[model samples]
Every structure is written in C-alpha cells, then in structure tokens.
Target: MRFSRAIATAVATAALAGSAAVCVPASAATPSTVAINAGGSAISASGTSYSADKGNIGGRTSTTTVASGTTDSALYQSVRYGMSGYSIPVTNGTYDVTLKMVENYWSAAGKRVFDVSAEGSAALSDLDPFQIAGGKNKAAQRTFTTTVKDGKLDLAFKADQDNASIAAILITPKTTATPAPAPAPAVGINAGGSAISASGTSYSADKGNIGGRTSTTTVASGTTDSALYQSVRYGMSGYSIPVTNGTYDVTLKMVENYWSAAGKRVFDVSAEGSAALSDLDPFQIAGGKNKAAQRTFTTTVKDGKLDLAFKADQDNASIAAILI
Candidate 1:
C-alpha cells in the first residue's frame, strides 16, 4: 500500500512538533455522526466522508496496505501519533464511539503501549495495536457505548511508553434496536487433509471436492486444535460446500507455517463471487508463523451450494481448516 517514507517522516516530524493547528468544522457536517482520518487528508470510506485530521495531535502516514476488515486502506495508512488526547465537539447524547487503529510503525509487541479514556473514564487499557492485530499494517478496532454530557466528547490518550496513536475515529448515535446474534455454521473441513475433531467441532477431512496439496506441521498458538492447524492445504483454488439455502457464518481456520514474515504470504478470499477478504496476510494476521489466525465471514448459500475462491497476491494461498 510504500510511499515516500523519508519525506513523509520529515514532514510529519515538523507538523508533530506543533505546526498543525486544530481545525474547526465548516458547519457543513453533522456533529452526531463524525468520522476523522486521524493523520491524513479528508477521504471517503464506506460511504462516509471522514474529515481531515482535527484536534490537537500529530500524525504520520504510511504506504503499506491495511489488511482485512476494511476495504478503505487509506483510512488506516496514516496515524495520529504521540497525542495526549482529542476534544471533539459533539451533540450531547448517547453515542457509539469506534476507534480505528493500525500499527504502521512498530512491529513487535510492547514497543508501543497506551490507554484510551472516553470522556473521563477508561475505555481501553494497555493497548498494543501491533500485538492485538497480530502484525503491522493490519486493522484493529475498539468500540464503546458512551453518553456524552458535555458539549464536547472528550478523549484522553494516556501514553504508558513511546506514544499513543490512532488512525481514525467514528462517532454515531446509538440505534434503538439491537441486532440478533449471528448463527453458527454447521459445516467444517480439514482442507486437503484428513478430518479430525478439535474444540468440540467435528471437522470433516478435506470435504467438498477439495483440489489442493496437503501438508502437516505444528501450529504455535491461538487454538486448542493443534492437529487441525498442523494439516494445511496450499495452492488450493477454492471449495464448494453443499448446504441448504441459508445465511451462515463461515470461519477460515488458518496458520502460517512456511512464511515467517508479513507480506510473504498474502491472498484474498471470495464468497459467492464477492470479496470476503482482501490482501489477507496469514503471517501478519496470525502475528507469526505457526500461530493460529482465523477470520469469520457471513455469506448466504443461494444455489444450494456455497462457492468459495482463493487468489494469491504473494506466494501460494493456503489454509489449515474451514468451518462453514
């Protein structure tokens, strides 16, 4: 997603030193629904127009593409780092606050530590975006429901070490209706390997006319099923699981057993010919090789079958197991 790193760093250093002033809104937007691209210019994402970096803070930009969860990589390419907090003017009422964070700078855990407080109470503590996200250039978010009494919705970033940072902030009025929980899937696959049981789920061994090569290796962490993760199918094209017409949650059980670093093994996942995951880095999302990482997506089976496709961006695409 690499830009002119040297130049961007120099420019950010200067602005971070206090050259950038707090920007006031132009009265063209609503205060209840607010989206801010923390350290970057104004951009639109998912039909929402996020304002330019506002409040009293500093920001830096990166060229790396944000992995998974969001299609708008630009929203997370820049970050408002080393900030004490932000004071955003908002309508007084109950609101859902969502903070979009990405570790574009640090790679290892504990390198950056911070806590965030909404209004005056703590909302997120001991936050390590890199650790929480598993790797850099990955998306991580925290949402909290809060009531804003004052004219402004105050946020404080208490830096425990290096500096506190944020990529974007979104505020929206809470809805009255609470959506029902997602229903679990009834299908599971071992993906090019033999079927085995783990974590109370019975995964069928390489189901749904699998077309890939299978291998075995040890998985480090993130699941109780080491056997499930140990067996993997690489260079697989896709899978077509037969099921009754209905919507279900599909979870891809994955681990990076070959590639040791991010970007080495990157790919995209498709469900029913629609993009499910883009630029999915197993090594990055799972934190490291042999570590368990899984992504759950909801899709509907219309043709009495669930069609899934995998396209590789870097090396060969792979997966350990599948839960449909």
Candidate 2:
C-alpha cells in the first residue's frame, strides 16, 4: 500500500535597523520511491519502476521459493537473501521507508532472524518475519520514519540466525523541519555602566573597576550612541568583563570621537591576560574622528570569567561597549 505525501509550510523572520524581512527556502523535492526486486529480475508494477538486485550482488541465492504469494504478482514470486542490505540514493531530509517481505524458504520463526537499521540508527532488532506474519510463507511489511542528510538511505540487515531477505521497497518524503525557536539573550557591556541587556544577550562592566572611567559620560558628536552605547569610559586601565569560563567571540565597540587620527589613541587589548588586539586604534580603522569602530576577536576564558585589560600607547583608551 502507498501513502499520499503532504508538506507543511515554514516561515522565518529577521530584524535589522528597525525593519523586518521574511525568508523561505526554494522548496523541497517530492518523495522518491525506489522499488527493488529482492532476489528476482527487475520489472515495473503498480505504476512503480523496480530495480533488480542492485545491492548484495554476490550474496544472492539462486533457489526460487516453491511457495508463491497469494497476491499473484511477479514481485511476490522471488526474493533475495543477504547478511547486509542496500544503499539507495536520496536528497537531504526526513523520509518514510517501507520494506516488503515474504517468508519463502523459512517457514519457522528463529530459522531466519535478523536486525535492521536506517542510516546507522537502529530501526528494528531481533526481527522474525515468519513469526510476525503468524508462522508461515506469507507477505509482511515493516515501516520506519528516518532522516537522511548524507545523500543516501541505507537499509542494512545484520543476520542473527541465518540471513535477511526482502521483496520490495517503498520510500516517501516526510515533513521537513519547522523554523527554529527564538535564540537566548546575548552577553554584552556598556563601558561604564553596570550591565546592558539586548537581543537575548546580557552585558556587564562590574567585575573590576578601571581608574579614570566615569559611568555618567556621553559620546561625542557624530559618534554611535544607542541603548547599548549610551555610556562612555576613557583611560589606560585594565577592566575585566564577567563571563562563564569557555571560548567566546569578543567584540570591542568603540569610536575615535576624541581623536582625529589613528596614532592618537592606540591601545593594546588582552583577554584572559592574552593579547587579542595589539596596538588597536579606532581612528585608524574608521579613518577619522567621531566615527564608530568595532573590533572582534576570539579568546578562551577560565575560572568562570573573562578578563579584558587595556594598555594605552600614544593617548588614553576609550570604549562604548563590549559584546561577548
């Protein structure tokens, strides 16, 4: 028996600069059905094209079953036996796989027992087709829902008693994944303030205080200022940003509003006592005063926090925000 395929629509939304956009994929392909004639020759039936003995080439048994399926179809007349099964080509996604079987040579349960797996995941174990179909030479079926992302569907059979056999195969496309859930808050800091929170992330500047830093200062004209960049700090002191011990992407949000050129406010930055940004100058990156500059680097933090220290070279160092 065959089942109809139905797909569910998914949607995702992204916000940038106070505006939103909706996006979707190019749409997935229809389900692919590959019917294989287990041990027999190939022929199409019931509007489905059948492949002949594509897998387990040398493991085939030439013996034809004296018993025949009551359905009186060519597919029910022959079958193949093997220790391992086949690998069918497919696209990346979830699918529904159906295997058709008929107990031919083995009329007893334990005479031909085996296990089945789909793409390395367990599908069935200790399978006894003869027992499942009520002890005889009859037709039976097993179905499983699985995901295929590595470009193929592997139907593997490991024999426990004698060997495993199959008569036909049916594959159909299953529903795709829906949009992911909203992300958690990010971690960040407002230079002189206690903690700044936004976009599912939190920022803080309350680990160790750096001298010459003011919590009530404002940015200069033409400089970046928002909820995340409201406060400003200037000095040549070391400041530690509290964060869980691990590797993180660190971003230093700054502006050269106080200086007109690169060499005026050069500073060396270190995270966890390691040099991350050496001789970094916002004016050099943005090319002028009152322009914003952002520097990003990766570092490892230990002992439940990250330590960020700044050493001034030519002039005093300044920062508006720190994001992790």
Candidate 3:
C-alpha cells in the first residue's frame, strides 16, 4: 500500500503545533459520469448512435447494430470529444491503474471491433482480449502498475470493431510502499503455560497450552480452548489497546478451533474498549463438524489503541486472540 510519508509526518507536526491537522487531498479522480466519443472528438453512430448514458464510467454502455459477415463492421464511429482527458500530475511514486470495461458486445462470429490502450511512455502495451462466449455482451477488467517521475498521465482508448459499443472507463491511483517487519514480543512460560508481553507496560496477555503442550511465543492474549483463559488482555472488558498516536495499519492473528464445540462452532466478532482506534470490526468464523479456523484482521490506527472481541455461536467453537 502506498502511504504519503509527508502526510504521516504532517499529522505528527500538527499535534506539536496544537492545531487541527490539514488533510492533504490525496491524488484521485473525482466521481463524474461522462462519455467520450469514439472516432474523432464527437459521439456519432451509423446504424445505431452511441448513447452518452451507456458510455459514462461505471455504467458502460455501447452502440451496436444487427449485422452478420466479415465485412459488416460499421456500427459506431467518432472521436470522443469535449470530455476532459485526465492530466494527473504525479511525483516519483508507484501507482496502480485499473480500467473497468462496463459493457462489450460482439456477434456470434468473433470479430475484433475495438482496441483499448492506456498511452504513455510508462504505459503498458499488451492488453489482450480474452475469448468471450459468442453472441452476448461481455465485461472484463485490466490492471497495471507503474512508477512515474514528475509528469502528467495520459490514458487513451481506441476502437476497431465494426458494430461495437463502449461503456465507461475508470482510472484510480494507489500508492505502493514496503512494510517493515514487526518486533517480536517477549514470552515467559511456567509449568501451566506462558505469558506474552510488550516492551513497555502497555500490553500483555497470558496463554495456556492444551494437553501440556509447550507454550509458543506470541504477541496477544486469549486462546481457542474453552479450558484456557489466558491473561493477555489489552484492555478492560469494554476498552481497547492504546497505541502511540499516529497513523498505522495494524494486523492481528488468531487461532480457531471447533473440536470442543460438540463438532460444530459458530461465532461473531465485536470490537470495543478503545476510542483511539478506528475500523474496529475485524472478522467472523463459523465452525462446523470438528474443523478449526484461523484468521487475521487489518485495521487503521488513528489515536492510541485498538480493542477487539470475539463471541462464538457454536456448541464448542472458540478463537485465540493476538494483536500486532
């Protein structure tokens, strides 16, 4: 995921300045439904005129005609005009681009009606059309990732089909960043089980092993076994773990078990206990017939803590909780 390092730093500076943080408008395309002409710079159809409604982004519609033969390729022709072309100013960064083909139609006899390409020196050139079932409208999507120096982005699409219709094209920008590895917490084990805790006095959890198995080192507290009630609680019954105020993407891993639930387990998740956290609800697991489930959740940290809870709905299903 691409995150604005400058934005991250600015948020910290805002706290020192004792002022409301100014949000940087992340680079993105505003939502607007507009259609581009196909041939020149205007929408014109021969056997059938292309409707602007169909060409709007997210609502891809194309103009089509009822004609059969290798040479009957005259359906719609025009250069998409007046519609604004994207002139995105990008700095040195990685970006993800996606083109959504909302609507496409072709006759039973496969014929190449149109070709779409995103044009730029950084542009990728090989967007091959996958085989479509004959005689029906088809939809597909293409994606590309590229890095850019300071420059403007120019995306272009061209059509070559005889009686082809196009819906709308959509483009979005995403940042790419390398993540740092997490620091492993310390674990202390006794004859009963083990206890895991962080560097400071902020977070702690106690976990017990089943059948006298050696306890493993982990980050959070709580286990999937009903016989165990580890003490790795990050918050009180209704609070969440407090983090150092900053923007962060937090992830947690946990174990799931269905063996104790009389062969079936079901559960729902709830997050509470911290106000400094956002994006609380993480996951749900339904256990069935002696199966165990393990899963993780990712959330955005806004203030200082992240709190989470899981409630089972099975006869003996349970989950082990861990926080990163």
Candidate 4:
C-alpha cells in the first residue's frame, strides 16, 4: 500500500535494461501489426482501430488496427480523432512500453499532433509537431517508459491529424522480483531473569534453570519447554497461568507414564478461570496411567488471562503435560 515514486522509477530502469533485447527481437524485424485484441480484452486499439498504415511513431516495431467501430465504450471519452490501444498483463514489477506513430499525410496548414496516455493520464505528449511531405508519408518515433502496478497495463493513443498510420506497438517486461510482504504486529510472552511473565516487556529468565517449579508427582517441573509457560502441566485441581487476551487455538496433550509397578492413575484435564475449561469439553483428556490423552480447543480471550487445571484421583501414579 505504500507507494514510492522512486521505487517505481528504479523498477522501470531495471526492466528496460533487461528487456531491451526481448522487446526488439531480431525476428521482430520492422514492427508488424498483431491482432489488437490477441492478448485479451485488456489490450485494444483506441482510435480508428490500429492500422499498419498509421505508421509507427513509437519506437515499437509492431502495430495493430482497432477497426473504426471497435472503440471501447468506456474509453470513448478519452479518445479523439483516430485513436486505438493495446493492453498487456503487467506483473507487480516495472515496465517500459513505447508506441511509435507514423504520419502518412499532412496538410500545409494543418497541424499533426499525437498524444499518449496510460490508463487515462495524458502524461506523455508529442515532443513536437509531426511534419510529413504534402501527400507523402513520413515517420517519427517517440519513446517513453512508465511504471505500472500488478494488473493489466492499458496504453491509449490519440492524434489530431488529417491522416496517420501506425507501423508497430511494442510492450516489454523489463525485470521482475518478488516484493516483500508487510510485517505483522509482534505478540508473545516475555521472560526476565528467573522471572517469567505473559507481558513482552523484557527478557531476563534464568539461563540454565526453569523459572518456576511444579509438583513432580503430578506435572513435573521443567517438563515443558516453551517461550510461554502454558506448556507446563499441573495436578487435577488445574493451575492458573497468565496469558494476554487474544483469540487463540489452544492445544493440550497429556501423557501418563506408569510402570506396572507404579500402578494406574486416573485423571481428567480441562481449562478454567477467565473462560470455563469445561465449556471446551470435547477437548477434555480422560484416561488411566501409561496411556496418552489429547484434546484441542479454540477460544477467544478478552481478559488477558488463561487458567488450566487437571483433576486426578491419585496415590502413586501421575500424568504430565505433553504440550500446550
């Protein structure tokens, strides 16, 4: 959305440099008139349908006729005398498109002037009046490059002259590169030395140690490792953790590991506090020790806080928070 005139100028320069050869192919010889609508409705002939006889005034060696009645209804207001145009697909890069008009006939007292415009802006005008021998054909060439956004590129030409001809119209893509996308707002928890907080104020968490400890018999301390403490697990009573308010798709995975000698531990997992963890039921974890339980829940938080708890009838076995 940020428009930079300088960036557009740079793109135009690069495209012209790289596409010169492609635009003037040896096989391209003296510009020939291709079907004005060959590319699609996006490109067309404006005045008097592009005619090979219009003579190429632009540097482009190719030209086309728009036919007298083929003028676009929408662009009719922008055209006068005999005008026609062609459209080309413009990528998000820069481009340099040139059109050449040729004067076939001129009157001793009449002025022969031609103007060029992009979309509709008449920024390109004739350098001077085109002069041709009375009743004889003469050619003049003009070149100009403009930057276009990603989409269809429309070029229109109009002339105020008694008689004119077009030899060729040329459009070339000069260079292309992927533009970087915009950045998103930063959002995440912050850790300060030995102190963990949901706020992203600073970073100071203890380097080699876990900031907080949890009951090993239940959710062992250091069991979870994440920039956010939401990964840590707690016993069935479910423990509260701090979180910034925002829409979040919360995921919970429970792992119960109990050897035959450790006995079975029955447990259930749920979220609570700011939002009822039970409301996210289907996402509840239920099972016995040595078995893994998983649940996923999505909810919107407006109170900048998230509390999660787990309940278990235990004496020896326990469950660990696998992930959050």
Measured by lDDT, the strongest candidate is 1
Taking all chains together, the TM-score of candidate 2 against the true structure is 0.43
Model 4 Cα lDDT, one tens digit per residue, 58-91:
3322222422121342211121134365465545
Give per-residue lDDT, candidate 3, residue 94. Answer: 55
| Number of colliding residue pairs in each model | 3, 9, 37, 54
Model 1: residue 116 alpha-carbon error in angstroms: 5.5
The Cα RMSD of model 2 versus the native structure comes to 27.1
Candidate 2, poorest ten consecutive residues by summed lDDT = 5-14
**Model 1 lDDT-worst window of ten:** 21-30
Per-residue lDDT value at 59 in model 2: 60
Error at 198, model 2, angstroms: 49
Name the runs in model 2 displaced over 4 angstroms: 1-29, 62-68, 175-324
User: How far is 139's C-alpha from truth in model 1 (Å)?
Assistant: 7.7
Predictions in order: lDDT: 0.80, 0.68, 0.35, 0.39
Worst 10 residues of 4 by lDDT: 278-287
Whose TM-score is greatest here?
1
lDDT of 2 at 154: 84
Clashing pairs in 2: 39-79, 39-80, 185-200, 185-201, 186-200, 186-201, 186-202, 188-202, 188-203
Ranking by TM-score: 1, 2, 3, 4
| Model 4 stretches with alpha carbons more than 4 Å out | 1-81, 107-110, 127-129, 132-136, 160-165, 175-324
TM-score of each: 0.60, 0.43, 0.29, 0.27
